[model samples]
Target: MSTMRDVARVAGVSAKTVSRVMNNDRYVSDDVRARVLQAVDELQYVPNVMARSFRSGQDAAIGVAVPAVTGFFGYVVEAVERIARDRGVAMYLTCLGEDPDGEQAAVEALLARNVVGLLLAPVADDQSYLKPWRERTSMVFLDRRPRKLSAAYVVHDDNGGTRLAITHLLDHGHRRIAFAGDSITVPTTARRRTTYELTLFDGGVGMDPFLVSWGAHRVPVVPRLLALPDPPTAIFSANPSCSMPIVRQLHAAGRSEIVVLGFGDFPMADALTPPVSVVEQDPTELGNQAAQRLFRRIDEPDKRLPRQVVLPVTLVRRGCCQRARMGPAA
Candidate 1:
């Protein structure tokens, strides 16, 4: 148990300066801070986090309850973990598996650990679990936000990202464009579906019920759409996860004429046969922003402002977005 006095003596600084360096007070000068750290390391001195917490009253851990690691949520979680590591915050990652009950359970468990904050993608629209613990912890929702919870959040503009992909297809002279998404139960898919339909309607393209196909949350509707009398010239699968079934269906149907665009960037965007073109969400930036926002909230909880940050997305065009005038199938 090397005391602050030992560190101060070796570093030639006051005991008060040692305390400032340990607590990251940011008031100490650069040179003194460096020497203090070197001395502490040379002495193999470990600060008592429990004692520090008793004095500072901070647990220094955040609870992040993520939805299943299937599609966009999975990518978002990965980026957030990196930010967590850089911030030196302990992140307790739990999978909700898209289950409302499971999400509730996870939240309860994290709260019990005296977690200072929470980053969540609200699984259920009904935030019954949040009512009691809302004040105890600062909660930030990621990806999909709940309707009623008025707390701070970080989410991609689902409407804007989808609009970019759809607009690209429309601009490429593909009038009979179609959309494939999982059912409207999921908030993310539902928002994207709205964007796709509204974009077509705004462009004077009549709504084609036949062109819209739905599937299970994990399933793809490629086969059903391809079976239609007039298949779409361009297709926008809801997200990259949906791309697998769509591409697989295209190969199985032996149809290569239709152009395809995926919602989010694919890991192997360039390696695919046609190379996937996508509207990419910067989740790394999102995570960094989330951490920045969370710490700010923890540092100043009494502040009346609720900061909601929406990150921008970019469309990466590739060969897959190209299209040509196609004759009806034989």
Candidate 2:
């Protein structure tokens, strides 16, 4: 275990100089900094993270809480981790994995570990559990905002993006565009469902409650919808997990005539028989921007009011929705 004293002795500098270099103080001359770093590398010295934080009265590390380390949230985690690295900030990553109790526990554990701030993609319906730590910790919500709690956050334009997808279908003469998604109680799902309905109504298309399906078993839902006497001419899936399964099921059922568009892009989405068209939200930007906001709050706790940032989205048309009406009926 190499210590700061060891590095200082090897570099022929006082321990105080080594401490200054570790803190990244501008007062340390460039020549001294180089020697200290070289000595640190050669000695394989690692600083005590908690001790460093205690000495500075703040942790340079920030904690990130997400649903999981894959899919949409995975991209966000990568982006946040990259941005944190570039900014010379440490990161503590935790995945809550669809459990409300786990979400609360992750936050508590991050706080207990003394992270300076948190970037959270919340799962809990009510975040009053975090109220006690609000004063001491700086947190920025990502993907979804906390219910009944005021905090800084970054989210995509859910309504606008879904509207774009529905409108694109409408332009292609899709009269009945079915929507497949998960439980609407989730904030993102709720916003997307609301937008899908509102778009249909605003486009002068009649809204049929039967056209909407909710659950993880969207593969079965699609077949039932297709069985309807007045089946949808096109379908809009609101999230990535729902999107991929819907496409696979439709393809397997030999129902390629039914057009499918989705809310997020996936691997090989463009490689399908007819590549999938999608409403693309920038997950990287979502994570990067959320982390940037969290860092700012950590640096200047009282500098600004809580903010809500909505990143823009675009509808990426690959071969999926290219053709005009071959008559509206499927």
Candidate 3:
């Protein structure tokens, strides 16, 4: 209810002085700042953020766009929110689902709010559309890099992680290994799938197209994969969404012989009957680094920072990937 003008009147200072004091301007003397603070407290004055943003041409908040606020992405959101709270800034979040077509519109909606910075986990392959807004807003890509647009990004080493998982399986003597994922269109899935094939090829076991399964949360692929004449001895799940369902299906069918290695760790992974092993990627760290890069961009709009940051991943061995049992031929 109380406005800056009211505080200024009570503090016996001009509205401009009140504004400077509220913004922590160093030019205002200590006595005047104290008087303004006392008046603000007495009147319960709350500065309107929207008004301030309108006057300054940018909001004191940041925007985040992700596929969904669940699983690994949920952890990223929590981390970013923590940093935003610590910085005394607000965050606006939007879930773009799995559709790449909707990505541009959703991002534009956030930009329309005049957000000072944006942290995006983009689904679209090409992000050249964001080029026009680059001058006004600080944009940092998270988890995936932009294709056409060169910008600051923080992402996991998908190729290295996938190699680690596939090599682990190969070390355990899993020659007949399969790849399970959401969709090949996704950048992360594509990278992991490529690495999975390359690692298998390098290990002297060429890729088997029939062994790869991908769709939108479809679990029936598991049964189909098992029904093959030559079933895979191991499967490399590209993400947690694919990992959980495949693990569930295998557990229900009592197919403990088929090994599974996931790309990202999830809850209940260690509690499964044959605890799932994974190439561990820290979503919290990814989010933290991405948020930090975004703030850096906001602070130094003209300074040239590194274009990309690739964080390393580690493999967590567990009960799933065991030495292959000798088949009848062997």
lDDT of 1 by residue, 1-330 (tens): 676689999999998788678767668889999999999999876554333334446576778887666566666667767655554567777777656656677778887787777888777666655778877677777777766666788888889988888888888878888888765666878899999999987777887988877772366576777777777887888876677678777767776577778777767767877777888887667766776676667645687755677788888898787754675435
Query: How do the residues 1-330 of candidate 2 rate in per-residue lDDT, one tens digit apiece?
Result: 677799999999998898778767789999999999999999987654434456557677889888889988999999999867765778998888777767787788887877878899888888888888887678899999788788888999999999999999988888878989977767898899999999998999988999999884344677788788788878898888888888888887887777889888988898987888999988988988998787667645678755999999999998678544443335
**TM-score of predicted model 2?**
0.81
For each candidate, the alpha-carbon lDDT, in order, equals 0.74, 0.83, 0.87
Which candidate comes out best when scored by TM-score? 3
Which pairs in model 2 have colliding backbones?
none
Ranking by TM-score: 3, 2, 1
Worst 10 residues of 2 by lDDT: 47-56
For model 3, how does the per-residue alpha-carbon lDDT over 1-330 read when each residue is reduced to its tens digit?
777799999999998898678656789999999999999999988654434455567888999999999888999999999877766679999999999999999999999998988999999988999999988788999999888998889999999999999988899898889898899879999999999999998999989999999982675678888888888888889998888888888878778778889999988899887899999999999999999788767755688899899999999988777787654212
- Least accurate stretch of 10 residues (summed lDDT) in model 3? 46-55
- The list of candidate 1 runs beyond 4 A from truth reads 1-58, 70-75, 328-330
TM-scores, in order shown? Answer: 0.80, 0.81, 0.83
lDDT of 3 at 39: 100
lDDT of 1: 0.74
